[model samples]
Target: MFSKACEYAIRSLIYVTEKSKNGERVSVTDISTAVESPFAFTGKTLQKLVKQDIISSAKGPNGGFYITEEQAKANRLADVVSLIDGNAVFQGCGLGLKICKENQPCPLHQNFKEIRKQLKKMLQSTTVAELAESQATQKTFLNNINRN
Candidate 1:
Protein backbone atom coordinates (compact mmCIF):
# COMPACT_ATOMS: atom_id res chain seq x y z
CA MET A 1 0.00 0.00 0.00
CA PHE A 2 1.12 3.55 -0.69
CA SER A 3 0.89 6.57 1.54
CA LYS A 4 -1.93 9.03 0.87
CA ALA A 5 0.59 11.44 -0.57
CA CYS A 6 2.01 8.78 -2.84
CA GLU A 7 -1.44 7.83 -4.07
CA TYR A 8 -2.25 11.44 -4.91
CA ALA A 9 1.13 11.89 -6.55
CA ILE A 10 0.62 8.89 -8.81
CA ARG A 11 -2.91 9.84 -9.73
CA SER A 12 -2.05 13.47 -10.33
CA LEU A 13 0.96 12.56 -12.44
CA ILE A 14 -1.06 10.17 -14.57
CA TYR A 15 -3.77 12.78 -15.04
CA VAL A 16 -1.21 15.42 -15.98
CA THR A 17 0.38 13.06 -18.46
CA GLU A 18 -2.97 12.25 -20.01
CA LYS A 19 -3.62 15.91 -20.70
CA SER A 20 -0.03 16.92 -21.38
CA LYS A 21 0.63 14.24 -23.97
CA ASN A 22 -1.14 16.49 -26.46
CA GLY A 23 0.82 19.55 -25.29
CA GLU A 24 -1.87 20.82 -22.92
CA ARG A 25 -1.17 22.09 -19.43
CA VAL A 26 -3.27 20.96 -16.45
CA SER A 27 -4.31 23.26 -13.66
CA VAL A 28 -4.19 22.29 -9.98
CA THR A 29 -7.93 22.45 -9.56
CA ASP A 30 -8.47 20.31 -12.63
CA ILE A 31 -5.82 17.83 -11.56
CA SER A 32 -7.35 17.51 -8.08
CA THR A 33 -10.82 16.99 -9.48
CA ALA A 34 -9.66 14.49 -12.06
CA VAL A 35 -7.71 12.51 -9.49
CA GLU A 36 -10.38 12.92 -6.74
CA SER A 37 -7.90 14.45 -4.33
CA PRO A 38 -8.18 17.51 -2.12
CA PHE A 39 -7.19 20.74 -3.83
CA ALA A 40 -4.66 21.85 -1.19
CA PHE A 41 -3.19 18.40 -0.75
CA THR A 42 -2.89 17.91 -4.47
CA GLY A 43 -1.23 21.29 -4.79
CA LYS A 44 1.37 20.37 -2.17
CA THR A 45 1.99 16.98 -3.76
CA LEU A 46 2.43 18.58 -7.18
CA GLN A 47 4.92 20.98 -5.71
CA LYS A 48 6.97 18.08 -4.36
CA LEU A 49 6.83 16.28 -7.68
CA VAL A 50 7.96 19.46 -9.40
CA LYS A 51 10.85 19.80 -6.95
CA GLN A 52 11.88 16.20 -7.63
CA ASP A 53 11.80 16.94 -11.38
CA ILE A 54 9.21 14.21 -11.85
CA ILE A 55 6.96 16.89 -13.41
CA SER A 56 7.17 20.50 -14.53
CA SER A 57 5.14 23.65 -13.82
CA ALA A 58 5.00 27.37 -14.50
CA LYS A 59 3.21 30.46 -13.23
CA GLY A 60 1.20 32.91 -15.32
CA PRO A 61 -2.08 33.33 -17.16
CA ASN A 62 -1.20 30.37 -19.35
CA GLY A 63 0.88 28.42 -16.81
CA GLY A 64 0.18 25.03 -15.33
CA PHE A 65 1.78 21.63 -14.83
CA TYR A 66 2.81 19.56 -17.81
CA ILE A 67 5.17 16.68 -18.46
CA THR A 68 7.77 16.79 -21.21
CA GLU A 69 7.85 13.95 -23.75
CA GLU A 70 11.24 12.85 -22.50
CA GLN A 71 10.04 12.97 -18.89
CA ALA A 72 6.96 10.91 -19.64
CA LYS A 73 8.99 8.33 -21.51
CA ALA A 74 11.64 8.05 -18.84
CA ASN A 75 9.70 8.01 -15.55
CA ARG A 76 8.44 4.79 -13.99
CA LEU A 77 5.97 4.21 -11.16
CA ALA A 78 8.86 3.09 -9.01
CA ASP A 79 10.55 6.45 -9.57
CA VAL A 80 7.52 8.31 -8.25
CA VAL A 81 7.15 5.86 -5.39
CA SER A 82 10.79 6.31 -4.45
CA LEU A 83 10.59 10.10 -4.72
CA ILE A 84 7.49 10.32 -2.54
CA ASP A 85 7.72 7.37 -0.17
CA GLY A 86 11.39 6.48 -0.35
CA ASN A 87 12.00 2.68 -0.13
CA ALA A 88 9.66 2.16 2.80
CA VAL A 89 7.29 -0.03 0.87
CA PHE A 90 10.11 -2.15 -0.50
CA GLN A 91 12.36 -2.26 2.60
CA GLY A 92 10.13 -1.83 5.64
CA CYS A 93 9.02 -4.78 7.79
CA GLY A 94 5.65 -6.12 6.69
CA LEU A 95 4.51 -6.72 10.25
CA GLY A 96 5.80 -3.37 11.46
CA LEU A 97 8.67 -4.84 13.44
CA LYS A 98 11.21 -2.30 14.63
CA ILE A 99 14.15 -4.36 13.42
CA CYS A 100 12.89 -7.15 11.25
CA LYS A 101 15.27 -8.65 8.73
CA GLU A 102 16.15 -11.95 7.08
CA ASN A 103 18.50 -12.85 9.94
CA GLN A 104 16.02 -11.80 12.64
CA PRO A 105 12.94 -12.64 10.67
CA CYS A 106 9.45 -11.61 11.67
CA PRO A 107 6.48 -13.94 11.25
CA LEU A 108 5.57 -12.45 7.88
CA HIS A 109 9.08 -11.53 6.75
CA GLN A 110 9.76 -14.30 4.21
CA ASN A 111 6.33 -14.18 2.62
CA PHE A 112 6.34 -10.42 2.60
CA LYS A 113 9.80 -10.30 1.08
CA GLU A 114 8.60 -12.27 -1.93
CA ILE A 115 5.56 -10.01 -2.30
CA ARG A 116 7.75 -6.94 -2.10
CA LYS A 117 10.04 -8.22 -4.82
CA GLN A 118 7.08 -8.82 -7.13
CA LEU A 119 5.67 -5.40 -6.38
CA LYS A 120 9.00 -3.72 -7.03
CA LYS A 121 9.30 -5.48 -10.34
CA MET A 122 5.81 -4.45 -11.39
CA LEU A 123 6.34 -0.85 -10.43
CA GLN A 124 9.71 -0.71 -12.18
CA SER A 125 8.23 -2.13 -15.36
CA THR A 126 5.28 0.29 -15.40
CA THR A 127 6.01 3.71 -16.85
CA VAL A 128 3.93 6.90 -16.66
CA ALA A 129 3.50 6.92 -20.42
CA GLU A 130 2.10 3.40 -20.34
CA LEU A 131 -0.41 4.38 -17.70
CA ALA A 132 -1.42 7.52 -19.57
CA GLU A 133 -1.77 5.55 -22.76
CA SER A 134 -3.97 3.01 -21.01
CA GLN A 135 -6.21 5.82 -19.79
CA ALA A 136 -6.23 7.57 -23.14
CA THR A 137 -7.25 4.37 -24.91
CA GLN A 138 -10.11 3.90 -22.40
CA LYS A 139 -8.50 0.79 -20.99
CA THR A 140 -8.41 2.32 -17.49
CA PHE A 141 -10.14 5.00 -15.44
CA LEU A 142 -8.38 7.19 -12.92
CA ASN A 143 -11.42 8.06 -10.80
CA ASN A 144 -14.19 5.81 -9.50
CA ILE A 145 -16.99 7.84 -11.01
CA ASN A 146 -18.82 6.57 -14.07
CA ARG A 147 -17.98 8.86 -16.93
CA ASN A 148 -21.18 8.04 -18.77
Candidate 2:
Protein backbone atom coordinates (compact mmCIF):
# COMPACT_ATOMS: atom_id res chain seq x y z
CA MET A 1 0.00 0.00 0.00
CA PHE A 2 3.02 2.21 -0.29
CA SER A 3 4.49 3.97 -3.27
CA LYS A 4 7.33 2.29 -5.19
CA ALA A 5 9.78 4.88 -3.93
CA CYS A 6 8.62 4.33 -0.38
CA GLU A 7 9.12 0.60 -0.72
CA TYR A 8 12.66 1.03 -1.95
CA ALA A 9 13.34 3.63 0.72
CA ILE A 10 12.32 1.22 3.46
CA ARG A 11 14.25 -1.67 2.01
CA SER A 12 17.35 0.36 1.32
CA LEU A 13 17.27 1.92 4.77
CA ILE A 14 16.96 -1.43 6.45
CA TYR A 15 19.84 -2.84 4.41
CA VAL A 16 22.03 0.13 5.20
CA THR A 17 21.11 0.01 8.86
CA GLU A 18 21.85 -3.68 9.09
CA LYS A 19 25.27 -3.27 7.57
CA SER A 20 25.98 -0.15 9.59
CA LYS A 21 25.23 -2.00 12.78
CA ASN A 22 28.00 -4.39 11.79
CA GLY A 23 30.41 -1.49 11.18
CA GLU A 24 30.12 -1.50 7.41
CA ARG A 25 28.94 1.16 4.98
CA VAL A 26 27.10 0.16 1.82
CA SER A 27 27.42 1.46 -1.70
CA VAL A 28 24.44 2.38 -3.86
CA THR A 29 25.15 -0.41 -6.31
CA ASP A 30 25.33 -2.98 -3.54
CA ILE A 31 22.19 -1.68 -1.85
CA SER A 32 20.20 -1.74 -5.11
CA THR A 33 21.24 -5.29 -5.79
CA ALA A 34 20.52 -6.36 -2.24
CA VAL A 35 17.06 -4.76 -2.27
CA GLU A 36 16.30 -5.45 -5.97
CA SER A 37 15.77 -1.80 -6.75
CA PRO A 38 17.10 0.26 -9.64
CA PHE A 39 20.47 1.72 -8.81
CA ALA A 40 19.57 5.27 -9.81
CA PHE A 41 16.25 5.12 -7.99
CA THR A 42 17.92 3.77 -4.87
CA GLY A 43 20.53 6.49 -5.05
CA LYS A 44 17.87 9.16 -5.33
CA THR A 45 15.95 7.71 -2.43
CA LEU A 46 19.14 7.53 -0.37
CA GLN A 47 19.84 11.16 -1.18
CA LYS A 48 16.43 12.14 0.12
CA LEU A 49 16.92 10.13 3.29
CA VAL A 50 20.33 11.68 3.82
CA LYS A 51 18.97 15.15 3.24
CA GLN A 52 16.30 14.58 5.83
CA ASP A 53 18.94 13.26 8.29
CA ILE A 54 17.24 9.88 8.43
CA ILE A 55 20.49 8.37 7.07
CA SER A 56 24.06 9.54 6.70
CA SER A 57 26.71 9.42 3.97
CA ALA A 58 30.46 9.83 3.56
CA LYS A 59 32.69 10.29 0.53
CA GLY A 60 35.90 8.91 -1.07
CA PRO A 61 37.62 5.80 0.22
CA ASN A 62 35.82 3.93 2.98
CA GLY A 63 32.66 5.96 2.38
CA GLY A 64 29.08 5.07 1.68
CA PHE A 65 25.64 5.33 3.28
CA TYR A 66 25.06 4.23 6.85
CA ILE A 67 22.84 4.96 9.83
CA THR A 68 24.04 5.84 13.30
CA GLU A 69 22.70 4.04 16.35
CA GLU A 70 21.07 7.25 17.49
CA GLN A 71 19.40 7.72 14.12
CA ALA A 72 18.26 4.14 14.05
CA LYS A 73 16.63 4.48 17.46
CA ALA A 74 15.13 7.86 16.68
CA ASN A 75 13.53 6.88 13.37
CA ARG A 76 10.42 4.80 12.93
CA LEU A 77 8.82 3.24 9.86
CA ALA A 78 6.19 5.94 10.06
CA ASP A 79 8.83 8.62 9.61
CA VAL A 80 10.03 7.13 6.32
CA VAL A 81 6.47 6.61 5.16
CA SER A 82 5.57 10.17 6.00
CA LEU A 83 8.71 11.51 4.38
CA ILE A 84 8.15 9.72 1.08
CA ASP A 85 4.37 9.47 0.96
CA GLY A 86 3.25 12.17 3.35
CA ASN A 87 0.27 11.62 5.66
CA ALA A 88 -1.95 10.55 2.79
CA VAL A 89 -1.86 6.91 3.77
CA PHE A 90 -3.13 7.83 7.20
CA GLN A 91 -5.59 10.50 6.05
CA GLY A 92 -6.63 9.80 2.46
CA CYS A 93 -9.91 8.26 1.36
CA GLY A 94 -9.76 4.58 0.61
CA LEU A 95 -11.74 4.95 -2.59
CA GLY A 96 -9.43 7.64 -3.96
CA LEU A 97 -12.13 10.27 -3.69
CA LYS A 98 -11.02 13.87 -3.95
CA ILE A 99 -13.13 14.71 -0.94
CA CYS A 100 -14.13 12.01 1.50
CA LYS A 101 -14.82 12.93 5.08
CA GLU A 102 -16.56 11.44 8.07
CA ASN A 103 -19.89 13.03 7.20
CA GLN A 104 -19.47 12.41 3.48
CA PRO A 105 -17.80 9.06 3.69
CA CYS A 106 -16.76 6.85 0.81
CA PRO A 107 -18.00 3.29 0.47
CA LEU A 108 -14.91 1.90 2.17
CA HIS A 109 -14.25 4.82 4.48
CA GLN A 110 -15.12 3.33 7.86
CA ASN A 111 -13.36 0.05 7.25
CA PHE A 112 -10.35 1.81 5.78
CA LYS A 113 -10.25 4.25 8.65
CA GLU A 114 -9.88 1.41 11.14
CA ILE A 115 -7.27 -0.31 8.98
CA ARG A 116 -5.34 2.90 8.60
CA LYS A 117 -5.41 3.47 12.34
CA GLN A 118 -3.94 0.06 12.95
CA LEU A 119 -1.36 0.53 10.22
CA LYS A 120 -0.34 3.89 11.61
CA LYS A 121 0.10 2.42 15.06
CA MET A 122 2.20 -0.42 13.73
CA LEU A 123 4.42 1.84 11.67
CA GLN A 124 4.85 4.31 14.50
CA SER A 125 5.78 1.57 16.91
CA THR A 126 8.30 -0.16 14.65
CA THR A 127 11.79 1.30 14.81
CA VAL A 128 14.43 1.01 12.07
CA ALA A 129 16.78 -0.67 14.54
CA GLU A 130 14.25 -3.39 15.21
CA LEU A 131 13.84 -4.03 11.50
CA ALA A 132 17.60 -4.19 11.02
CA GLU A 133 17.92 -6.63 13.88
CA SER A 134 15.23 -8.82 12.40
CA GLN A 135 17.05 -8.80 9.10
CA ALA A 136 20.45 -9.41 10.67
CA THR A 137 19.13 -12.40 12.58
CA GLN A 138 17.42 -13.77 9.44
CA LYS A 139 14.10 -13.56 11.26
CA THR A 140 12.75 -11.64 8.26
CA PHE A 141 13.65 -11.46 4.61
CA LEU A 142 13.51 -8.32 2.53
CA ASN A 143 13.46 -9.73 -0.98
CA ASN A 144 11.17 -12.44 -2.32
CA ILE A 145 13.99 -14.73 -3.41
CA ASN A 146 14.07 -18.02 -1.54
CA ARG A 147 17.39 -18.32 0.21
CA ASN A 148 16.85 -22.00 0.72
**Considering every candidate listed, which one attains the maximal lDDT?**
2
Pairing residues by index, what is the TM-score of model 2? 0.97
| TM-score to true structure, per model | 0.95, 0.97
Candidate 2 positional error at 34, Å? 0.4
**What tens digits encode model 2's per-residue C-alpha lDDT throughout 97-120?**
999998999999999999999999
For each candidate in the order shown, give its overall lDDT on alpha carbons. 0.92, 0.95
lDDT of 2 at 58: 97
Give per-residue lDDT, candidate 2, residue 12: 95
What's the lDDT for residue 71 in model 2? Answer: 98
| Residue pairs with backbone atoms closer than 3 Å in model 2 (clashes) | none
Among all windows of ten consecutive residues in candidate 2, which has the lowest summed lDDT? 139-148
